[model samples]
Target chain A: MNYTLHEQEFTQQVADLIQQTACILPEDIERALVSARALEASDNVAYSVLDTILKNVDVARKQQQPLCQDTGLPVFYVHYPCGISTRIITRCIQDAVVQATADGFLRPNAVNPLTNKNSGNNLGIMIPCFHFMEWDKPEIQVACMLKGGGSENMSIQYSLPDAKLSAGRDLNGVAVCVIDAVIKAQGNGCAPGIIGVGIGGDRVTGMQSAKKQLFRLLEDENEYPELDKLEKSLLAQLNKLEIGPMGLGGKTTVLGVKIGMVHRIPASYFVSVAYMCWACRREVMSYKL
Target chain B: MNKKIEMKTKHIQLPMNKINTRKLKLGDKVLISGIIVTSRDMAHRWMMEEKSDIIRPYLKDGAIYHCGPIMVRDGEKWICRAAGPTTSIREERYQSNIIQEYGIRCVIGKGGMGKRTAQALRTFSAVYLSAVGGAAVIYANSVQSVKAVYQLDAFGVPEAMWVLQVKDFPAIVTMDANGNSLHEDIEKKSIQNANQNQ
Candidate 1:
C-alpha cells in the first residue's frame, strides 16, 4: 500500500476546507442556535436578537457567505499521524491560507499586534500552531476554527485545590464568579453565546481542554453524567441572568454550558472557561488522497 | 404573551444615498440607504497618523461601517469576503475623535462604545448603530455596491477601507444623542440582577 502526499492535493484540501466554511455552519453551532431559539423566552428583546441571528444563519447558508465578518484569527488543531512530516504540514497550511485568502474564502486577519502590520497572506509568526498527538491510524485529521477575538477575550481560568472542591464548592460562589466575569465582559464577547468549561488539570492543560471541548457536537453526550448535569444546570442558571442577546435584556443569555473534566492531582483542580460567539466557526475534516 | 405594544416615535428618513450624523435620533431604527466606508484599527491608525483629508470625501453624509471586511478581487472587481462587525471597544479611543474630525454622523459596529463615544454621540448628534456581531454575510448583503478601496495594498485587504453602497441596512439604535447607551443599560441591569440573586 502506498500513500502519497502532493502539493496539489494539499492545495485542494485547503480550498475545500475554506469553501466548506462558506456553506456549512458547523453542526455544533447550528445545534447551539436551535437550542437557543427553543430555550429562548418569548416576546423579549433576547428573542428578537435570536430571531435575527437565526435569520442571519439562514441568509449566510443560502448565499454561501461567511456567518460573521470578523472571520477571526485562524486557529488550526492538527492531529498528525505517525511518520507525517510536521514541517510539510505547516507549509501546506500556510499555503492554503494564502490560497484561501486569494480565493476570498477567508479574511486576512493576521496582524502584528505591536507594529499593527497586516500579514497579507494570513500567515503570521507562531500561527497555525500544530499540537501533535500520535494516533495509531495512518490518516490525519485537521480541525480549524476562526476564533474571533470578541469571544476569545472572554476566556477565563481558575486553579482550585481539588476537583471535589468544585462539586462540593458553593454553587452560589461559582455562579457569582462566572456571572461577574461575564458581566465584566460588557457585551464584548457577543452575548447569547455558549460557554465551554474545562475542570481539573494544570493551567495550560485546563485551558487547552476548555478550547478543544468547544469542538464537541452540541448534541453529543458527555462521557460523565455528573458533568453533563452540571452543564445543564449552569446553562439554566446563566440564562436566568437574562443577559439576553447582546446583553440588551432577554431570557437566553447563554445558549449552553459544556463542561469537560479530567482527573487532577488530589492537591489541585484547575478550571478554565472558553466562550464562543454566535458565529462559532469550526470545521472538522478527515483527509484522504 | 407579553402585550404586543407598538409605539410610534418620530421617524427620520435619510436618503439611502447620503446620511449626515447630525440628523439621527435615539432609538431610531434606521434603514440606511446609501454608500458607506469601512475602517477598523489599521485604517483608524492610518487616518490619525496621516491626518490627511483622504476620508473627508467619503464622510459627506455617508456612513462609516466599523468593519474590516474579507475581500477577494476578480479581475478588476472586488468581492466581499466575510465582512462582519468588529468589537467597537478598540475604536473607542479613536472613534469619537474620528467622528468629530471626519464629520461622520452614523457609525456601525457591534458590542458597545465607551463614555467618550457616548458623550460624542450626545454632543455631535451622531448615532452608534449595533449590527449583530457574528452576522458578517448578512450585513454584507446590504452592501449593494463597492465604490472604492483605500490603503493596505501590501497589508492585504483587512486594513483597507472599501467604500460600499448599502440599502436598508438594518442596525439597532445602541448609543443615542441624548447620552443613552443600551450596552450600559444591560451591564447595570445584569449586575443588579446578579447582586439581587446573591
Candidate 2:
C-alpha cells in the first residue's frame, strides 16, 4: 500500500481535529451523564451537579470554547498505512497543537518538570505524546484525548499480594485495589468519573494500558467474559459508595468502569487505574485520501 | 438521612461581611456577584511572598477563586473564554494564611480542602464553595469583565492573577464557616460503604 502524505494539508486537518476535540463532548459520554442524572432524585444536590455539567457541555459546544480551563495534555493514538512515515505524522501533530493553543482552542499546559518553566506554547519535550502503529488500512486514523491534570492526579497504580489491602495476585485483589483508589480519590477526580483499569503488565505498561482503555466507548461491551463481570461488579460497588458528583453525597460515583488485561511475569502482578473526569473530551478522525 | 430536604439558594455579594458568610451552611446553593480574584499555585505562592498592595484591596472581604482561566484579547480588553475552578485541595498549604491575612470571606473552587483549611474557615468566618469542575464556559459566561490582571508577563495567562467582575456565578457551599465539610462527610460515608461492599 503506497501513498503520498501531504505535510501542510495534514497539519491543518490535525489542527481542526484538536479544535473540535477540545470543544465538543462526545455523544456516548454525554449520554452517560444524562442517564446518571436520571438516577439521582430531583431534589438531590447530585442532580443539580449533573444538570450544570450537561449545561456546560451545551454552552462549550455552541461557543466553541475549551471545555475546561485546564485544556489538558493532548494525547494521540495514530493508526496509519504501512508506507506512511510516522516522523512526518508526529511533526504535523506537534504543529497542530501549537496552532490550536494560539487560537485559544487549548490552553498552554506543557510545563518543564525540572525548572517549572512553561514553554508559553503547548510545545515542549513529549508534550503532545503520540503512539503510532502501522496497520493494513489505507486511511490514516487518529484519535485524540485531552487528559486534564485534576483527574490525572487521581490515577494510581498498585503492586498486588500486599499485606495491607490483603490483595493477592488474583481478581479479588484487583477489585480491592480499584475500590481503594476510588475511595481515596473521592470527589477530587471530578466524580461520576469513568474508571479504566489495566491488569497484569509491568508498572509502566500497566498504566499505559489503563489510559488506552479510556478510549473505549462507555457503552461498549468487553470481549472477555471474566473482565466484563469484574467491570460490572466494580461499577455497582463504586456507586454504592455514593461519592456522587464532586465528592458530594448522592448516588452515582462512576459513570462507567473499563478493565483491560495483558500478560505478566510470574513475580509481579500490577494493577493500574486511570480516572477520567466527566468532561472526558476525546475525538477521532479518519482521513481517506 | 432523608434525601427530601429542599436545598436553599442564596445570592451572595462579594466583599462579603462575616455575618453574611456565617449564615451560609453546607449544601446551600450560592449565586455570587461582584469581583473575584483568580489565583492558582504560582499566584498563591506570590501572595505569600509579596503581599502586594495592588491585590490587597481585592482580597479584603472578597472571594479568592482557585482558577486558571483561558483568556483572549480583543483590542485593548481581555475576554474570558473559559474559566472553571481548579482543584482546591492544591492550595491547602497557603489557603488558611491567605484567608486570615487578606480578610477573605469566601474561597471558591472544586475538591474541598483539608482539615487545616476547614479549621481556618471556622476561625475566620469564611465558607468554601465548590463550583462545578470542568464547567468552564458556564463560568466564563458569568464574567462581566476583566478589571485587571497581575503577573501576565511572568506567570503567563493560566497562572496569572485575574481580577474579574462577575454576576450570579453559581456554586455550592461544600464547606461552611460553622466547621462542617461535605467533603469529609462524604469521604467517611464512602469508606463505610466500601467496607459493607467488601
Candidate 3:
C-alpha cells in the first residue's frame, strides 16, 4: 500500500489550529462568562472578580498574548482511521508542538515532576500526551486540549456505591459532590469555571470521559434530553452555592455543567468530575494530510 | 468595625487591622498600604543556611513574598521579566522557620502554606496573604521600584532576591496570626457543609 504524506498541508493545518487556540476565545466559553456575570449576586465580590477576569481575557486576546500565564500541558486525543499509521500521527503532533512552541504560539509548560526542570519545548516524557481511538472512517480527527494545572488539580473520581451512600446517589448527589470539591478547592483551581461530570464507568474510564467532555462547547445542547436536563439542573444547583467567581462570596460559581455517561455494571457506577478554568484553551482539527 | 494591630519586623512597622477571613474574600482587591518584601524558597534557604545579616536591612516590620520571578537587566537597572507567584506548597518545609527566625510579620503568595506556617503565623502575630495567582502582569504593575538584588550573579532570575518597593499591592488575608486562617476555615466549613447536605 502506497501512503502519501502531505507535510506542508499537515503543518499548515496544525499551525492554524495553534494560532486559533492562542488568539480566539471559544464562543461557548464567552457565553459562559456572560452567564456567570449575569447570575452573580449584585453585592458579591466575585462579580468584580469575574468582570476583571473577563476583561483580562479581552486584553489577552486583543494583545495576542496567552489567555492565561500558564499555557498548560498540551493533550491530544486522536481518532484515526483504521488504515492510518499511529506512528505517523504521533510524529505529526510532536512536530506541530515543536513548531508551535518555537513560533511562540504556545508556552512550554512541561517539566519533570520531581526535578522541576522544564522541557523548554513542551515535549518532555509523556507530554503532548496522545490517546488514540480507532475509527472506521478514512480521515483523522485531532482534538487538542491545553489542560492547566489549576483546574486539573481539582479532578476527582468517586466510587459510585460508596460516594452515593456518603453523598447520596442521583443527579443532585453528583451536583453536591462537584460543588463541594470546587468550594474546597477555593481559589486554587481558579474559578468562574466549568465542571465536566462523567457517570457510569470504571474509575479511569470515568476520568477520561470527564476530561474529554471538557472539549465540548459549553452551549452545546446535549443530544440526550435527560442528560441535557441534568446539565442545566447541575449548573443551576452549583451556581446557587454562592461560591461565586474565584471562591469569593457570589452567585456564579460554575459557568456551565456538562455530564457525559455510559453504561456500567449492575453492582456499581463510577462518577468523576473535572473542572476547567476560565482560561479553557482547546481546539479541534480534521485533516486529510 | 475594623480592629487595628501593629506588626513590627526589623525596622519596618506595619499597622494592619484584623479582618474576618470570610469577609476577606478572594478578589476583594484592596490597597495593601503596608510593608511587604519579596522572598521565596531560595532566599529563605539562604537566610537559614548563612544566618546572614543580608536580610536585616529589609526585614524590619516587612512582609516576605514567596515568588521566583523572571528578571532582565537593562543597563544598570534590573526589571521584572515575568514575576509570577510560585505555588506556596513548595515552601511548607522552610516557611515556619524563616518566619520565626526573621521575625517576619506577613507572607504573601498564591495558595496558602501548611499547618506549621499557620502555627507560626499565630505565634508571631504574622499573616499570610493570597495574591491573585496567574496575575503576574497585574501584580507587576503595582511594583513602584526595585531597591536591590541579592546573590544576583550566582543564582538565576527565579532564585535571586530582588528587593522591591511597592504601594497598594492587592492581597487577600488567608491566614492571620490570631489562629485564624481563611483557607483552613473555608476548607473545614465547606467540607462540613458538604457532609451535612449529603
Top TM-score prediction, candidate number: 2
lDDT of 1 by residue, B77-190 (tens): 877756677778888888888877876777888888999999987776678887777777777777777888888574457768888877767777778777888888887887
TM-score of each: 0.88, 0.97, 0.76
Candidate lDDT scores, in order, read: 0.71, 0.91, 0.67
Ranking by TM-score: 2, 1, 3
> Against the correct fold, how does model 2 do in TM-score?
0.97
For model 3, how does the per-residue alpha-carbon lDDT over B92-147 read when each residue is reduced to its tens digit? 88888887787776678765777999888777667777665555445555576788
Off by over 4 Å in 1: A1-3, A38-44, A159-175, A262-269, B1-27
Model 3 chain A poorest ten-residue lDDT run? A40-49
Candidate 1's residue-wise lDDT over A116-231, tens digit each? 77777778887655576657666767788777778998788765423533333333434544565567665678887777877777887877888887787776767888777777
Tens-digit lDDT track for model 2 on A1-289? 6799888998899999999998999999999899988988877789989989999999999989988878788899999988888988899999999899988899988878776677878888888889888888888999999978899999999998977999998999999999999998998898889999999899989998999999999988898999999999999999999899989888899989999998899998999999999889899998885
lDDT, candidate 3, A1-289, per-residue tens: 3346676677667767876676466877877777777765544445556665666566556655455545567888888766678888788878888877766566666666676565666788888889999876667788878766767877777765464346556765666667666765665666667888898788878888888888888878887898899888777666555555555546666778888987777876678889887667888888863
Per-candidate interface DockQ score: 0.55, 0.63, 0.18
Candidate 1 lDDT for residue A172: 40
Write down the lDDT that model 1 would get.
0.71
RMSD of each: 3.9, 2.0, 6.0
- Candidates sorted by DockQ, descending order? 2, 1, 3
